[model samples]
Target: MQGDYQVISTLLPLENPDHLEARGIHVVRTDVTKDVSVKELKDFLQKFTGGRLDILINNAGICYTMPATDTEIPNVEKMFAVNVFGPMRVVRFLHLMLIEAKGVVVNIGSIGGICPFVYGSSYNASKAALHHYGNTLRVEMRPFGVRVVNVISGEVSTNILKSDHGRSLPQGKWSSTADPAPMGHTDTRAESVFYPLNEEFQKHVHRTPNAITPNQYAEGVVKEIVKRAPAAWFWFGASSTSIRMVDVFLPRTTWDWLFGRMFNLRKLADGLPSQIKL
Candidate 1:
């Protein structure tokens, strides 16, 4: 980070670019979801970093919360585009620099991929795909001296969630998750069977109110990346360790029951008719 540092994102950091420029860090406005922007980034890096990149972090991601059946096709496609394909596109264009420098590729994944958190079906699937991609990429890149590290991240204080009005919540603040808010971009359809769970769905969106600060998560990730032999998958961030332990030790039925209770699924089940027409 001390030498030749640059950050690329679809959206620039909120802070004045001057602040980062003052410290010799340049921000490039690039979109990973587009191949043209990714190629442009590669071109910029070729000139800026002298065709050598020591580290590449695929941190661009987006999330939406809703029942899987209720999730629109476009929403699912968009999430996969940004969260899964975005990383793959970036790596495809930039892997040469990473290979030249014997560098590391870090994919910021989520624990939601491992745990069946209600209302995060598509978001979870995207992360699961990313986690698998990183693991396989590691094997493929190893021959070229490139290291791929996948971070099974947990909750962090970031504006990853948007309000029903399409405004991002506050960054690094608990206020973002303090009150339940409707997560769906559209209003719940009255005809949908899941309409009765609207309140619970909103609550699930704001479930992780006490998330770790971004700085805290970053510090741990940096440490892992700098290690001489970092593990293939590193776990860090709020509740990450606990969730990993639960996944490792708990039975599938226990996990199902726990998540059901956590997300109000039990109540919904209790209200349903015991005899099924099907």
Candidate 2:
């Protein structure tokens, strides 16, 4: 049996503790966004592993649903701080150990990194930057026998929906009108129009149903790591495959048209009800 494998994250659910422990993984709590916390992690790694490090997975992330216009600069900075710079910090601090072991560094990016979407500017940009960073590092680290793998995931059933980290557009900002639906009555027209748009968006972006569990994602990660020569990139979950295909074959204008038709963005923008200023 392999000895303890050190894993660090901001939070680990108790329900999944046994899943990791079963694999002889020791969970270390650290804030990747903080320099002090990262240094502390380095110190802990030195003390615990005695200069031996194997696999490093940078999976900690947060998401929000805010329009680009409404997204504040500070929020963008915060997202980059956590999603982009955080992983770099870990890789930089642990480079020597990983080089010694010829270890792999796996960054958990998102499908949004490949396919940009509405109301996800900050989150998408951060992941996109991380993707590029990983790609560049892959070439640079080759001499040291360090493999940099970027994993792009589509929507899985996660706590991102509940989190307040991503951009948050105000009510009716993205909608056509505040009172598009009549009081006490549902708007079937809007639903009918938006459903296909949402589906088309999912087709391009690869949003997953509730079926793809995070445990399954974690298991896939383990499998990817075990490959004798792992892939430069891996996409897990249902949408992952489709999104990759689209990314390769589809043109930028085609994607833009698809997104525009699906979201009714132009319609929403033109049809927005006027606000009365006091």
Candidate 3:
């Protein structure tokens, strides 16, 4: 059967729709946070695909590297709006289409969900929620022959943390990894408790130089999607295997201790007020 591929992204530029359209992908402008945007996407798909959707990939996400204690509720809510509720909204609206086609729903999750990296508490929590949601979705959709796959993604080179985001990547520009985008919002709020640790946070948010290319990540994800019985959780992208091993073998205390020194949290804790000492 011929595949109908489409992408719904809030960030894709309308000025160059043909960039993806030339590859036969029908692009739809969608903001997953809003019900109206997702509903519009569903409506368009219903008409375009004859009320059947063979694959639904929830790939839109955002991240902030602020410490948990320093993170504003609005920022936390914003991440959840895109990272957690976005997939939930899409699945709710298009589940019937998925059931009709007995298709797959892939949630592009992050290894950050499993690994508690310092300064990424909100992003981690959001991804963890998505991962759990996808797990439960798999169980509920089984009888309908719909498979839900959660991709525990590792660091892939992307400009998600860059300031000038939403600019399309020029075609044929990918190498083993993309050029590093300058880290955006690398400083902590001056009045926050973690303000003194701004340098540590800056180091943490710096994109990994060893990250895989987007194309390499996509190739693995697509292979899992086309499987007759895809695994419930597929781990791919750079450092994914290593993170999986760490999650499986490391204890919580070990994790804390290792990360503490890695991000200078242990040093920071030593200088905190006596009353707050652990």
lDDT of 1 by residue, 237-263 (tens): 888999999999988677688877776
**Residue 266 local lDDT, model 1:** 54
TM-score of decoy 1: 0.84
Q: After superposition, how far is residue 65 of candidate 2 from its true place, in Å?
A: 1.8
lDDT of 2 by residue, 47-112 (tens): 977876788888878765555644556657777888899899989889998998899999999888
lDDT of each: 0.77, 0.71, 0.77
lDDT of 3 by residue, 78-194 (tens): 889989999999899999999999999999999899998877788899999999999999999999999999999988888677632232212222233233232333222233455
lDDT of 1 at 102: 95
TM-score of each: 0.84, 0.77, 0.83
- Predicted structure 3: lDDT: 0.77
TM-score order, best first, reads: 1, 3, 2
Worst 10 residues of 3 by lDDT: 165-174
- List the RMSD of every prediction in angstroms: 7.4, 7.5, 9.5
Candidate 1's C-alpha runs over 4 A off are 1-24, 163-190, 206-208, 270-278
